[model samples]
Target: MKRILILFVLAGSMLSACNKFLETKPEDFVTPDNYYNTEADLDRALNGVYNRLVDNFGRMYSRGLFSFLSISDEFFYKNITITNLKVMDFDAGQLDVGKLWEVAYQGIDRANILLENVDKPKMDETRRKAIKGEALFLRAYFYFVLVDNFGGVPLKLKSTNNPLEKYLPRASVADVYASIVNDMKGADTLVSDISSYNYNERVTKTAVEAVLARVYLTMAGEPLKDVARYNDALIYADKVINSGKHNLNPDYSRIFINHSENKYDLQECIWEIGMYGNQLGNTQLAGAVGIENGVECTDDKIGYSTGPLKITARMFNLYAATDLRRDWAIAPYKYVTNTTTGVTTKTPYTAVQIYDRTVGKWRREYETVTPKNRNYNSTNFPVIRYSDVLLMKAEAETQVSGAPTAAAYDAVNKVRRRGYGKPINTPDATVDAPAGLDKADFLTYLQDERARELAFEGLRKHDLIRWGLYLSKMQSLAVDISTNAPSGFRYGANAAKNITARNLVFPIPNTEITVNHLVTQNPNW
Candidate 1:
């Protein structure tokens, strides 16, 4: 996936690397009819669609979320007084909101263009099917983003240059999810298996199933409340497990360490966004992953990060003393590096002072790329991991069977064992979930388990929303901060305090409402 992107990036070293993405288009020079006839051209177009996940500031892995979902229970943006998206203080006109909206549509349009032209390429039938599947998967993914963030958006399926097709009305939420399920289910049969690619960056069969599991699980909760979909979610999750394509990476921290080092862990990470060198040199595939969500540091050699993201006390308290993930996911120490000699030194944080610590999951110290940029690094973001699949199975299975089934307990226990640095397949009485918990108690256990295992990974807020706990959780967190947080840091509570019912779905960007006559603002916006 990154191969095609890197080729175009190196084509013109003197030019701005950001502008090279436009080369993916046949619009400037080669026409679609002539361009879509070749395999190389198809690859370029596919890369264009994938690049949507890499566009620095607007991409999912960027600082755009220091205040959104990622900033919920697990962490908070340190500059809390600011009245922007980070603190839930902005409106539809906010610049970041508009940029993200534009970027998602850009991805959708690129996918649509490629899908429409895919049949013209006289390539191998299998390869053509794979390419089409990838496009379909990506388009559905972008729509998922829109539906998750903006409620329902105009579903743009084809490459339409006509204004009539462009200015469509919003689709209903159920219709959007129906389309997402259909597109991804079709893609599941067409894409290659995980074994087909050396990197997890490309779309694979397991990735499709993994995301389908998430979709069905989301559909079973919150606004949708289609509880019957729990069975469908369970089926998709089991499909991935039964496929024998993935397993929990033995070391919990190794998963993210691999991400920072540009390595793939196919056994655990089913799909990750591939990121390469800093925008400097021959590489242009980096984003703000480590730079925006890691421990704060000023040394470029050690990997500079203005990562103002700090771990919340609520999240830190979830981990037990023996859990290896506690120290890795949330920084247990602060950097005291000697800047002149670049001799790195980190002082361990005392247990009582863990509240001030930062997100350590994507530490820049492990990043292998040299001459790191102040704002960018080559840390790949996980789209779906095996642990997530296991957890989803545990939740969905519980919902479908009206209790924690034997398989459900096993699924969660594997993740717990791995977190405790024990053999993942072996039983661990000390750390595994206690047996015989009822449905309500099991879900309560899962809420804490998910926070401990998957925090600061951009999934917390959505999980809260789906569980119908977003408002209540934030309100409680505000109370927690008001009573316990330091005076300077009390401002961090604004994000939780500012949250309201209208915050459920971000307002459709004013930029879109201004141009798209058929589209209207979200309720209360």
Candidate 2:
């Protein structure tokens, strides 16, 4: 039996079993009066919110749809052709959009439910406040994703039973963004410090700042692209960078290792999802499901442990010879085992690992098995890091000042130097660059570095869109990786065939548009 914990509630489980705890019925089937009674209850509620991200449905809405659909061109890993990648079979027909739309609203619903009732009489004021802040941040996060992807989703800030209220037309993007801003601002104030909380599962003050910086940065980039918003983004990012609470981890390799729970590098990790091994943080899909590279395992196993996703030759070539980050990308290993037949069986597993850019950031094996089905050895995934904050600052500042400033260089170099194992330089000694780093040379450098640094944490797909270089890069890689594979390679053919333009915006899931007329399909899908 699964152990009941507060984190489970964050996973979106219904609380029907706890009917005995309610004091007053918010409805015939539910009541907030009986809930929100203890610190543990709040903790569980927050955990339940986090749990919503467990499966593909939950993850696709937050990452996969954006990463795979908007980012790269590679498609058909093995024999399966992903519609978003090929830009075909879209419309209301796509499952990716459906999952994304449904799960995001689900997350918002969970947040609303908690906010409405997590402050009952028996709840501790401090704990209740923290839970409220976390819920607010999560709701804002959900809305941020929704507005950015769908433009104007209906705003449902409250949990309501009225069927008419559920069918409201799409709200203006401005209204959605305003609500997101308000929620984030409240979160920043309510949870002023979360360094003490340390648990990755909980949101901290830095997390709120991180989200605010992103909000401002997105506003600075799109529709408005206002110079002032760029400055605002820089201000928020700098606060998180200099807060003295977080820093870049000295060892680049350690950032994604098994023991890296709750660890923040000194650079600028504003906020990240905290995960642990076991039920709380373990990921079977990330670990043992797919086959990457050409190492074939006969089992139908997808090889998430060490398969499915492999490092493209283009990415490998992008790393400079002296950069320590290259070391973090790929490690050569021979999987050797002694069998009962008195023979030693050894298979070479030489490829890039995957947390960020390494093929599998979490690579551990409970027992040696075929490539098709393998068990993961490690237990954590760093969803956000300080390096991204620097890149975001670099981009924002460049736009604000028109050329990369010395401040921008300092930020970029801080990450570059750390990647190359050099001592960090203080701001005073750094050289100046421009606003938005508009010059091709300067902006190009920042873009490449962002790729090298934040490779697989689910940013590649989105970054490609913002950069407007998605198709070119994917086309280049499909050709390059194919050339590098063993002559007449049979396995990666599908990956080469899956590139197209319709992939830019995943289609609105058919299920959603059928139910909510407010959800419009993305263009060209």
Candidate 3:
């Protein structure tokens, strides 16, 4: 399934590159009346929707979203945009903010177009339904991204037929979430079973359920504080776990490395956004997160990579030496070139230096096929993994019980055990297992474990925001970094003062406000 999807994307790209036939038609020239005629047309249109997953409007290969994760304590980047985010020194005019908004709406419009024309083709009922389900899921996912970042945004459920239909007022946050839930519920029945598919690249029943769990979990947290939703969160997460369709991959590193090879663990990855080829067509995750200006050795089959993304010293120190994920998740050294000998050697970095360490999760050296350009490697981004489901289940259980239940401990311990390379079924007190705790302590533990298990996967900021700890935590982290960081590495001076309640959600883009009078800026923007 993933290969087929990649081929479709590549074929579409080839067509556009070879000729101008696939290029955009003049406005007022192309219309739904002329476009929606066959199954092949629908497939081509649907591909446009999926293309947003890797589009460079906000930096391709999930870099736009991952940029938010970089602002959290776990990671850092030297780019001016990233620096602005780290210090909370950004507003409505931020380019990426506007780009993300534009790209998401573009995807939503594409999805709406597909939904409007899905039934025009005389195709198999199951196939048609699956296509419609995918469109709904994609739209909901795009809106979810928007709502999480920009608070309330204009909702466009149907395709726009004319210029008059383009302008839309912002929908209430509650209304937007309601639509998201409705779409996911509809998709749950329309999408096919995971086992029926060869890969988890596309939507499935379990994928819908997993995303519902995430949605419900988010609803149960900040800005809403609807604690009752925690039950729904637990119910949905448990459904995914008990479905027996997925489980945690024992080798955590393999989960990521497999992405570079175009291989997937359907048993672990619920849904992965597929990326293929090299250069502009490939994923930028490795180049954005891997070692900066490092070298490779032909004899050792090592490949080189360079990027601005780096791990924070605070994040690196969070891992216990016994945890296997530490070495696999954070690189402690970079390869240095011997100018005279033309040889490269590994050099350990100073522990407390900011931006001195690199991320290890997307290692370009482990790519199964060497990349034509080291800066662009085809590494699929994992959208949701089974391990996350377990942790979320644990979180919901604790929140619902107001204390850690036996099941809650089991869920969290499973991930912790895997981190230490211990057997999932056994409790290894010395190396893997931490002692059980009460509700408050367990929730705190779950937060840290999430950072440990899922750091740099683009969930950190959302997790902090939902926990209502975003401001306080960022403020505290600033003090710690400023106090402990080596003089030259101290970069958290503005963190304490700049981050505030108004930053809970980003300002609506100034471009959006300028073009659409119905759109209002977020508070304090």
- TM-scores of all predicted structures: 0.94, 0.77, 0.89
Arranged by TM-score with the best first, the candidates are 1, 3, 2
TM-score preference between candidates 1 and 3, better one:
1
Among all candidates shown, the one with the greatest lDDT: 1
For candidate 1, what is the TM-score? 0.94
List per-candidate RMSD values in Å: 3.3, 6.4, 4.4
Candidate 1 regions with alpha-carbon error over 4 angstroms: 4-28, 63-69, 163-166, 338-344
Order of quality (lDDT): 1, 3, 2
Of candidates 2 and 1, the better by TM-score: 1
Highest TM-score among the candidates is held by which one?
1
Pairs clashing within candidate 3? none
Worst 10 residues of 2 by lDDT: 16-25
Lowest lDDT 10-residue stretch of candidate 3: 12-21
Total clashing residue pairs per candidate? 0, 63, 0
lDDT-best of 1 and 2: 1
Q: Give the TM-score of candidate 3.
A: 0.89
Taking the tens digit of each residue's C-alpha lDDT, what string does model 3 give over 166-249? 688999887888899899989888988899888787789899999999999998998777789899999999999999999888
